[model samples]
Target chain A: MNEPQFALRIRQHLNQGARVDARVAAQLRAAREQALARHRSEPEAGLALASNALGRLGGVRGLSLRVLLPLVILGVAFATAVAWQQTQRVAEVEELDAQLLSSDLPIDAYLDQGFAAWLKRRASQ
Target chain B: MAEAARLAIALAAALLLLAAPPAAAAPEKDRRWSELNAEQQEILVPLEGEWDRLEPAQRVKWIGVAKRYPKMTPVGQKRVQTRMKKWVKLTPEQRKQARENYRRISKVPPEKRGDLQRDWAEYQSLPPQERQRTAPKKKPVTAQ
Candidate 1:
């Protein structure tokens, strides 16, 4: 209906937490009226015409890349970090394998210095 | 004259022997386990057992730490000794309890753990009297 009545309805809805603000409701009602008038004036070329035009223009894709580029960069950065962490773990495993294969010392010898010293003494003798 | 020719051949053989990649000296095996101080030995014995079961790669990983043992600070050494003492003193039941506690603590989200640590710091900073006051009180039961 009129703006004042629409605003009152919106205020009531907002008070109940339905979130319809007076200004927004009024704008919505105006848009609906305009849409209805357009349909009445051009019955044959209705909402379908608007829908076809939106489809041809690829609707949401028309938004500028400025908004989407940051999201794309963030996703790439997250994936790279995950990949780098995986590679780091793999490298650590490889290094451990290399060290193990190259060393000749018995595991106990590394832990026990007295045993190592005694062995050295025996070898020299 | 034939003896001089044989001597030259012997010299050539000696040079060839010297050139043959100094027979890969057998890997220097360290036998340091017996040298540890009693306390150190006590700590190391279990570690040795665990090390024995480890794959070569795992053993190699720990060898680097072993090599740096002499460079460890006195405090570091003492801390290690204390941990070893504690490990030795624990009953199997107590060790199980400690392990369960560790697992429970580990499962907590990092943010929650950070918050808890911060709270602990705050609690520790409070005066002894204030801490006593904040401590939980036993509730009295009323008969219905």
Candidate 2:
């Protein structure tokens, strides 16, 4: 028989409460009873809802950790670089200022045209 | 909607990284002569041809001096420019001697600096012949 005819005959037989071998019938009956018992014992909708809510919270926390950790590291690195640069610049400025102020020439003498000739004359002598 | 917001936040975070200026790859202390900024370059222009030949300490001093140049008054700036020109003309030995003399003078107490200034003024007022007579004579070089 064709596939449609075969299916229709099986449905009609099942509707008529057809009997199989005693052993096969017993096994089928036990399987159906077990499935119904499991259905009755299944978890409540409230319990499932609570578990889902906790899972969502955990997901958000995981997301925060993933994003936040890198950001903190980057921030620290940037701060350290800036601090180091500022310290270096300040030290440089201080040293240069000391050199400029402590020099013997009073700065203006170095600019005097006559001083150059004086230095040269002294050196030549 | 919540997922969309989280995604937007993540995008913002990523964009923040993109928007920030890149940190200097090398420290300012390690900057080469060619790497100097325009202002520094202009201020130290007389030293440009010999920048690489300068010692690290000298380079640092010049760069530091240039950095402070903008803070100086017009007269101070003019003095610095003239001094820089004079400094560039000195031989290495003369520069070294100048630095030593500066260090020695700097050690004098502030109150005593005036006395030193007076002595200098008296020396400056002496006649050339008299000044030469009092000046220290160089040791005559002997043949090996």
Candidate 3:
């Protein structure tokens, strides 16, 4: 089928919003097969180049793993150390809070309204 | 004579009490702003009203920088002054826009930034009249 005729038939089917006819389906299938066959037969230099490149990369993969594995491990260890330090700091803060609550010093007593009033009176005098 | 000596000793003790500095004043906690030098003051005045609005960590960060680089070069001082002046002139919305632009520029790769700077230097080297004539009429379209 001509390109224009094939496009017209596809458009007509789309406009009708119904399923395509068997003949149109067969034509489309044939076109797709033709394209695939051409693609398979073509001598693609890009593919050959890519295969050669991958072969080269395979040699470096071992070296890369040796270098990268330790780096990855170090990064994980550093992250864990930071998390542990943060947890320790939180624990220390809680301990301090507990100490503040239990202490004998009358810290809050000094902040009493009566004491403030007395200080204000003294300042005025 | 003994009475006079006793009186002198009492006066000496009183003067000693008066002259002694208070222990409570040793830890003189005051605004860190007052300790800034003239050049630092110029750089920091832009952040004046916004000083207390800053987080404790941010305040500490700036303070550390100020302490680390106590004195700046003449060109650096001038640049800081210009930036501060520009900062003060900007509206809140304009400031926000400037900050977003800065963040976007910073996110670009260092090599790209260097390239852009080199291009800008070349552009600036052109004669003023030529530069004005060649300048784009409209702002460059930026992708969202």
Candidate 4:
């Protein structure tokens, strides 16, 4: 058939309302059922997959350390400061102790009120 | 390879965190004679010439003494300055002897120190001949 005639015949048949033969009709029904079954199973499988992902993320193993990092750094800084201050204090005390041990006169002679009184009395005498 | 790089970065960060404290905790470096602040320099002016030769411990002690200088009464300050000058002039042997005497005297009980002081004073008050005759016998220095 000529191209115009063939195109006219296909359009007329589409407009007239076509029907499938029994075998083709059965095949179409089976394909539709298979697609619907696959569609139904897909949603359930997707939900199960999402649930598994959420479960893994909800446990302690999934916790992030970033939240605690600042606290850890602050604690370290404070400890360092305290240790440095303690050493400075110890150096001061040791210096004082060494001086007290090395002086020519007794420490009590320098600090004792009674000794000072005697010195005054002897001077007067 | 990317995961390994991330792990290495994390480990480096952790090591930095661990090392930071000790690095900061180390005592400040020994200061040079010229590095003393205005106040320290003023207080330690007497030892300026000998500052370079002083041992680290001696310098530390002197710095501590300088820090306490301003708090002292004028009389106390004068006495300390005088004593420091005397201490500086002493030979090492004389200083050692003084330290021995100091340590030995420190051990005497507080109550007994008064009696000892009285005896020493009375001894000093006597005539030179009597003082020499009454002088205590020499004894070995006590170990601290």
User: Against the true structure, what is each candidate's TM-score?
Assistant: 0.21, 0.36, 0.25, 0.38
Instruction: Please write out the lDDT profile of model 1 over residues B1-144, one tens digit for every residue.
Output: 643654565555455445432432222233354544465444355465444444443333334333434455665444443353344344556544443333333344554334433434554575777555533347633468
* lDDT by residue (tens digit), candidate 3, A37-71: 88975754564555566558776433434344345
What is candidate 4's lDDT per residue for B9-126, written digit by digit as tens? Answer: 5566567667655654333345678999998887667778888787675677677677667777676565566566556556656555555454445565555445554655664576
The 0-to-1 C-alpha lDDT of every candidate, in the order given, reads 0.45, 0.59, 0.47, 0.59
Per-candidate DockQ versus the true complex? 0.01, 0.03, 0.00, 0.03
**lDDT by residue for model 2 (A13-117), tens:** 897775688898899999999998888657445545555565587764334443554565567556655765765665654455445543445543333223333
- Candidate 4 — which residues are off by over 4 angstroms? A1-125, B1-29, B70-73, B115-144
lDDT of model 1 at position B38: 66
lDDT of 2 at B26: 26
Q: TM-score of A-chain in each prediction?
A: 0.35, 0.37, 0.37, 0.37
Superposition-based RMSD of candidate 2 using all C-alpha atoms, in angstroms: 21.5
Residue pairs with clashing backbones, model 2: none
Per residue, candidate 3 scores C-alpha lDDT tens digits across B1-144 of: 643654565565455444433311221122466666676566567667666665454454344333333355555444443454344344656544444333333344554333533434554575777555533347643568
Name every residue pair that clashes in candidate 4: none
Tens-digit lDDT string for candidate 4 (A7-125):
99999998765576889879989999999999978855865565556557665344334323344555666665577667667465534534553344444343332333333333445
Which segments of model 2 are wrong by more than 4 Å?
A1-98, A101-125, B1-33, B107-122, B128-144
Count of residue pairs whose backbone atoms collide, per candidate: 11, 0, 0, 0
Q: After superposition, how far is residue B132 of candidate 4 from its true place, in Å?
A: 6.8
Fnat value of model 3: 0.00
